[model samples]
Each structure stands twice: as structure tokens, then as C-alpha cells.
Target chain A: MKLLSNSKIWAVAVIMLSGLVYIGSCTRDNDLIVPVKLTQPFAPNRGTNIHLPGTMTVGDPTQWKMDKAHSSVLWSSNYIGTAGLLTGRFNQFGMHDVAAAEMLNYVATGQPLLDNSWAFNEANPAQTFFSGYVQINQSNTGEPGRDGGCNISGMGTTPIVAGTQNLTVTNLAKIKSTKVEFDASSNGYIVTFDLTWQGKLAAPLTKSIVGKLNYITMTTIATATPYKVFGLQLKFQFNCRDFGITSTSIADKIDIECNMNFNNK
Target chain B: MPDSFFAYAEWVELETFFAGYLLVYAIIYLVALNRPATGFVKTRLLPNLPLAYAFAGTLYLGLQLKNAYPDYTIEHLTAGVQLPYLRIWGLISILFWIPLLQKKPVFSLLHSLVFFFLLMKSLFLQLFTSSPGNDMARNNMKIYSISIFLNLGALILVTIISLLIARFNTQKRSTGI
Candidate 1:
């Protein structure tokens, strides 16, 4: 009782509380790691040049439709704290899907080429050789605050940055060898495309991806009705910083996987 | 799980909560630090800026720990920081950081009780996690239990002595000539 009433005890107690607050300030990071990991070379600065296998071939020119099948993008960033990780995906990515019914025989069997005929259309006169866009508003990380920040705070309001700057159709009449390359190997196709986020016409990034022909059909049974699925699967990892998105709390690496499931009909 | 909305929602909550807490700190600075309305911005609050940041950061870390592992207790050792939760240490930091009450001398029992309450909560949790599967968790549990016991013993001893003294007084009153 005497000790409890002692002024020294209270003084000690106050000091203890203050001590806790001090320790809280110092803890900035946790080195804890999840067992699952995605291994990529550490290039902290900006440019990452990845090269894949195969030879380039030239093929026929045509237009490809960009619609929403299951063509969504998934991204994970570093959490605010040093130890945590955050993951999220876009619900609506308007570009990247093509109807399954459309013949993908060109990609499956035809010779791989320096094809820039992705956006060529007979209906439109101002059509370019290859073009598509990603809507910026479609960026949703699940958390409202995070989604809001990604849209407004870090990167300014630019819906889509042209991956290739040479969009002038007249200039793109002749498909340039240096601009794009598609090499077919025994396993799949090695597509070396010029992928830029904010600027620069030529940023060659090679990815060994399975040909769209490999996964031909997907079935969806809706109790009474069944539907088949088909489309291209595009996967790539790029640092958000390259796209002018400045964020200290998030990991620079953003992995985008578009499993485009075109409509069966 | 890489793309699940709920997968990383906890981190978003952590960021939002900490940022929100900054506003409260600002209010405290205004109310306590800005006494006697100075012509120029008060310099007294300047020194406390770092301390305020420290309090908010650490508290948010604690909250982060809580969110990540709802099993958060005094015995919980943080994996990344490798720091065992010594909760009293946290309380001490908080109390010392309060510059406004730094000079004030107040109740000792109340402070002791507050610490005791913290210890009690941890002890309850320790009873369930006395033996954890992971070595880190087990070691942390042991440390947490020891700290609680030490504090409880001191607190009880004082109460016991006070009770014994009261009993002795009653006996004297009844048997006195």
C-alpha cells in the first residue's frame, strides 16, 4: 500500500508510457517475408530490358478488336509499412479482348512476323497499323483510398500513354523491323514489342508467352446454357515509376496479366 | 490471392488510420503548445514535432501489428522487426512523449493500475498461448508471461499489506482493555 501511494511509482509509470511512444517512432520497417515470391532482377532505377528467344517473320495485315472478355489487369504494390505487401486488380479494363469466334489461325499456324496490323480496319480510313489503350479510371486496387490515390494523387489524369510514339498511320504504312519482332519457338512465341509507358517510341521488351492458339476453348455452363471461351493471354511486369507514377509506399514492380476471354458467339 | 480486394485491405486501413491520427496530433499541438497566443508561430511546438511523429508512427505500427495478426498480445513478437511486444515499454514511451503533462505530478496508483490492466490483458492472452507452435511465438510468450507476473506480484503485495494492516487495527479495537 505504501509503495502504491509512493510518488516514485507514478513517476515511473509516466516515464514508461513516454518510453513506449518513443519506441513506436523508431520502428519503420519489418523484414518479414511471405513464403511466396515473384523473382525478377533488381533494377531499382528505371529501364528494364528483358530479352526472349526466337526469330522474326512478316505476316498479313488486318485489324484486331479490343473489347472486354476477361481481360483484366492484376497489380501488387508495397504496403505503407516496410514489411507488408498489397495486391489488387482492375475490374474493368475496356481494351485487350477479342471475340473467341474470330479466327485466331494467323497467330496459331501462320509465320510469326513484325506485324503492326493490330489496329488496321477497312471501315476507318485513319486507322493505324497497331493501337490500343488502357483507361486510367479502370484502375481499382480494392481499397477506395488506394484506388483514389492511384488515380488522382501520384500519376496525373492521363487515360492512356501511347506505347509506341509512331502512331501516324502514313508513317506506319511500311512495318518496320526494328519497331517489333515475333519469333516462334517449339514451346511458344517470343514477342519483342516496343512497350513505353509515358514516352519513347522504341522500348523493346521481350516476353516468351504461349500462343493464343494453345488455349483454344474455355467452357462456361450457366445451368441452362453453356458458352465457350477463347482469346489472348498477355502478361508483363513493369515498374510504375517508368509511367510517371510516383509513390514511396508501393513497390515499383507492377505485374499486368490480361487473360482476355472473348465471347463465344 | 494476388488480386483479391480483401487480400491487402489491412494495409490500406493502416495507412488511412495513421494519416488520420496526424490530425489529432496537430490539434494537440495547437491547444497545448500554442499557449498565450504569440505574434509569430510558436517555436515551443517545434521540438515536439519529431516526438509527435514518433508517437503516431509507433502507435500505427502497433495498430498494423494488431491488424495483421489479430492474435496480437504482449507475447506476440513481430516477425519483420523481430521485436517482442513489451507493452509496458510502449506505455512508457507514450507518457514521456506528452510534453504538456511532462511537469505535472499526479496519482501513482492510477498509473500502476493502468499498467496492471495492460498486463492483465496480456496475461489472459498468455494463458491461451502459453505454448505456441512456432519457436519465435513461444519465446515471445514466455517473455510476455514473465513481465506480467512481475508487475502483478508487486501490485498484489501492496494490496495484501494494506489489507493485513486493516485487519490488525480491527483486532486491536475488539480486544483492547
Candidate 2:
């Protein structure tokens, strides 16, 4: 009886002691510290022109140009719905300008072109053309970059109709190239590139081409010594084609120049 | 686990646990006042087990918050930030253990009151400050409140039963067998 009573007393004592210790240890205030932020190149600004490499017999490559108003093809798609389906009309593709920040993300993370494997057939010379799109980052004094090229033929042929003699094949391909160089002053970067496309029209009696050009520059201003770059300038070129003919081509560009003032307060 | 959700939930649980502690302590005190020693021990000790469990629960929650935000600062642990729950839990710990030292009914009752206030504060804060449609918050609040209420209720019931049993034993002892 004595031992049992003593044991119960000890149990209570132990519980009380543990609780006190826990409370005492937790009473002290914690100290505050600054949070860390990430520093890396933006995804959209990492690459040169974005385009797929393939030959398409539908249109002549000679019609392409650096000027925004004269381009022959254009297209854009953003998966906005919960099911990831295209929600907007295909005709409104290039009407809205791509944001510079978004472009930077694309440049850093996207691939621009499709390879030759996307071709329909090597035997049929006329039908074996490849078609794709590319986004290029080029500067007169810096590195040229590109992304977002899709080649349907490179995706490999899948027979849509097995029993019928007539069959439909789907192919997608993509590729990209970039060049980087510095000037005599070594103060700025320049990049440049030319993109070509050749392929059979996916739909007979109808021709379509999608293309875009964007020019951007980043410059730093001194608020503190050895200033940081925070300014961006951009221009765009778009093109579209219908029934083997160029129907719409538009150019839009915006120049944004601002100084980096770190101590604005 | 979103940091904000976890922080909010922890605060709620902390308060509810404290309030429960206070109610239990009060009930235990009332029973101890009129009851015999054996009756008091048997009725009070078992139900009080939840008090310890609440402490353990709060400790686990604190550890989780710590893990989620490794860079959690002292300011974050204080009044306005994520882990104010810890402060309430700390108070709970004091109420829980201090009673064991005094071994008096009054001290135990006081501890229960503190627990009750903290738990209520936790519930109120969660209801007012937390974002709506949080199923976890609602469920947790319900569980904590119900469990605390049930535990105290059961303790009181047991205390009443024990008192009756003691009375019967005493009447029998006073009379010649």
C-alpha cells in the first residue's frame, strides 16, 4: 500500500515537473531575421530566336523579313482553361502583345523548333517539307536567342484511317539556334538570326504561317556605384497566311527605359 | 501545407486546449471540496489525463510549425505572427504542472481556469481571423470543444457516483454489520 501510494505521488510530481520545464523553456522571445531572395536570369531572356527547323513546300522563304509590317505568318496559344484546352479564337492569336516579363520566362525555358524527323516522307520530295515557329532574342551588340518551335512531322506519323486507302498523318517538330558576341566598347550585348520554314500545308487548299519578332534591351543606371540593370525595351513582328497566300502581317514595338534607383526613399 | 493555414490552425488549437484545461481544473476542484479522499483520487485522476494529452498535442504542433518554416524568426513566434499558439501552450504547461507541485484543490482549480481561457481565446481567434470554408479548422474546433466538455462532464459524473458510493460505505460502517 505504501509503495503504491508513493508511486502515484511520483507520477504526479513527474507530470508537473515536465510541464513546468516545457513552459519555462518556451517563454523566451524569438529574434527576427531578414528573408532571402533568389537571384537568377529570367527564363524568357535566356535564349535566341525560337523556331522549328523543317521544309514546307507551301510558301517561299524569300518573303520573310526583319520588318514587322511585311511578315507573312503568325500564331499564339495559351492554355487558360482548367482542362488545358484552347479557349480563344485562332484568328485573335497575335493581336495582343506579349509582355516582356513573360517573354523573359519563355526565353529561359522554351525550345523553339522541330527537327527533320517531323517530315512526312523522304521519298515524296514535294510533300516532305517541315514547318514550325520560333521566338528570337537578337540585339545589335549582344547574344541572339530563340525558343518555341514546333514541328508536326517530327512527331512521327500516326494513321488516322487504317481501313481506307486515304490516311491522315500528324507530326510536330521543334529547334532553336543562338549567337553571342561583344562590341569594341564591351559595354553592351548584340544578337542576330534568320529563320526559314518549309512544309506541306496541314489542310489542303489553305496555307498558314505563324511568326513573331521581339527586340529587348536591359540597361542599368547608377543610384549606387556600378548600377544594376532594370530597364527593358521591346518591338514585335507578326505574320499570318490563308489559302497559300499571305493575308495579315503586323508590327508593334514599345521602348521602356528607366534608371535603377536603389535608394528611392 | 500552406504556412498561413498551419499558423492559423495552430493558434486555434492552442487556445481551445487552454480553455479545456481550465474547465477541467474547476470541475475537479468542486468535486474535491465535498468528496472523500479516495473518491476524489479515483474520480479526478483519470479525467485529468486529457490535460497531459493536450500538452503533448500542442508540443507536436509547435514542432510541425518549426519544421515548415525553418527560417521562422522570433518575431514570427510572437503576438502578431505565425506561432502565437506557442505562447498559449506555454501558459498551459505552467497551469498543468504547477498544480502537481501544490497538490491543493484550489491550485488545480486555478490551473483549469487558465486552461479554459486560453482554449476559448484560441477558438475565438480562429473563428474571427481565419479564412472561411476551412474544413480542418471547423472540425478541429468541434473536436477540441466536444472532447474537453465530455471529459469534464464525465469527471463530474464519476465524482457524483463516487460520493454516493462513499456515503453508502460510511452509513454501513456507522451501523453495526
Best by TM-score: 1
Docking class of 1: incorrect
For model 1 chain A, the run of ten residues with the poorest summed lDDT:
A169-178
* Tens-place lDDT digits, model 2, residues B4-28: 8866565555545444444454334
Clash tally for model 2: 78
Instruction: Give stretches of model 2 more than 4 Å off.
Output: A1-206, A211-265, B1-18, B21-104, B130-137
Compared with the true structure, model 2 gives a TM-score of: 0.27
Candidate 1 lDDT over residue span B66-91, tens digit each? 65686766455344332223333333
**CAPRI grade, predicted model 2:** incorrect
| Regions more than 4 Å wrong, model 1 | A1-69, A80-84, A96-131, A158-186, A199-227, B1-177
Query: Model 1, A227-265: lDDT tens per residue?
Result: 433454545556665555566767666555555444333
Superposed by TM-score, candidate 1 places the C-alpha of residue A79 at a distance from the truth, in angstroms, of: 3.0
Per-residue error (Å), model 1, residue A181: 7.4
